[model samples]
Target: MKAPEGADLCFPLLLNNSCRKPVPPQSDGMLVLLSFISLLTAALNLLVIISISHFRQLHSPTNLLILSLALSDLLVGLLLMPVEILSTETCWFLGDLMCALYYVVDFIITSSSVGNMVLISIDRYLAICDPLRYNTTVTLDKTKICVCLCWMYSVLYNSLILMDFLRHPDSHNSCYGECVVVLNHITGSVDFVFTFISPITVIIVLYLRIFMVAVSQAQIMRSHIAAVTQQSSVRVTAKKSEMKAARTLGVVVVVFLICFCPYYSPSLMGEVIEDSSSSSTFVVWLLYFNSCLNPVIYAFFYPWFRKSIKLIVTLKILQPGSCDAKIL
Candidate 1:
């Protein structure tokens, strides 16, 4: 059970002064899976980015939220996920400055992703519960401004959380190979309420209201189909479309909560949850794995996403005038 004398030292040259390198069982196998998931997340979110950006018809306000979500997930897959995977198997070879910067980038992307989800729930809530006003209220320009503000808010908020570490990156490190920045209980509590509690509460409540309205409308549509006028039929079709979009996005949100809840469990337990801890590695990866699963959820539920993937895979998107091609 003992690591042979110096086998546990991250820097054997430093002998007693070096931090012990953790030798987790089956770490090689885990690394391989993590690598694959990181690559998959990047590739899948890339498809989403290209699909929404290239298709003119897909440029709705709702799709803009999705585009924003995809951008955050793409950053996770491309940058944060890979770095976390490496950190799990080895010491932080990248300097303390990079370590502090890495966490800042991770927090900003994650908070923005959560913000996009909250925005999406609000979008669906309006579309389903107030269909008549949805278009006017959720205009493209307004949605664009909201998306910018979401990222801006995330950057500002997380910067405050990491301000001490940014100013003194090596303050918490006991040795050269370790990277850690601990927050006080007050900061931790503040982060939990804002990042985990408030946004999640809003998302769940809005979705609940949307769900009730959608069900009631669906029953009404079914019962009155034979006597429905042309105008009534058009309204019914729009309602169905809105309900479908809500349902699809609901799946994405549910999966997000499932993956995220575990990651925050330590916070809920009043424990100091450091990202560099071996105990938190599984939950952290589970959280990052959500990025890979988001695109899969879209492929299963949205026919347009499936079709877009086909066009992209076949290189049909390369032809002139492809942007005008009807995807929906």
Candidate 2:
């Protein structure tokens, strides 16, 4: 049954000016599911954070990028997910300034997460396709700098993209208790190119090349292993390691695209999208759900993550020399 006539107004006192609460067609089960996902997203990414941060062996260039990505995902669960859940059935009582700030935070974290994924693809590409220079070229210090630059670029780029909204916060709002942001044709196109097209292009191309190289390496390793030569064995072992890393990271990239592509489908159609629309809401939550899935993927694929989680859960990580424990 529909809610009673005036029951949906966010501000019953100013019924005419207030936007009605958005009661999405959500079942109680779905609401509970979303809540569980938000909590699980936070918990899973938090484990990744603690696993990578506290473990000395995980302090590598690639893990640093993963850490950066996890941090952004954690923000999604902690900050964005709850807001999204509340938004589904309620009107935005937080003023325009807060709305603008929320978008700013959302854009920065989301963009930075995308940037980090690109960096990870590049890292895997080098490890597989150019193993000779991968170590020197993609060092811990360099990865740290790149991670910093990615976040900085996200902040600056999104701020510029939303400059008008920041200046005139409620320029698009038709009533109180509604949070919505719409990008114009020009700004939307520009954002699509930078945040979606270019990064996706780079990731796809690099992964394709990495896939070919990994396949070739795998075939060579299998064909030559019977020789049992020391040099050949060493080469095979290295290639095998590289291929394994590529496969694991490939799963991550594929999942990222699956979760994110739907969210950007409107922009792909060259349309101005409203964030508050039902389709947009569903896809946005799908995007947030990716954050929860990442650590689960890691647990299934990475032995280190599984071990770390066990130690963390069993309180073994609290030991004085826990950081020195061999995890890999």
TM-scores for all predictions: 0.88, 0.88
- For model 1, the local distance difference test gives 0.81
Model 1 RMSD, rounded to 1 decimal: 3.9
282-320 per-residue lDDT for model 2 (tens digits): 789888887787667644467899899999999999999
The TM-score measured for candidate 2 stands at 0.88
Model 2: how far is 102 from its true place, Å?
A: 0.6
Clashing pairs in 1: none
Evaluated at residue 149, the lDDT of candidate 2 is 97
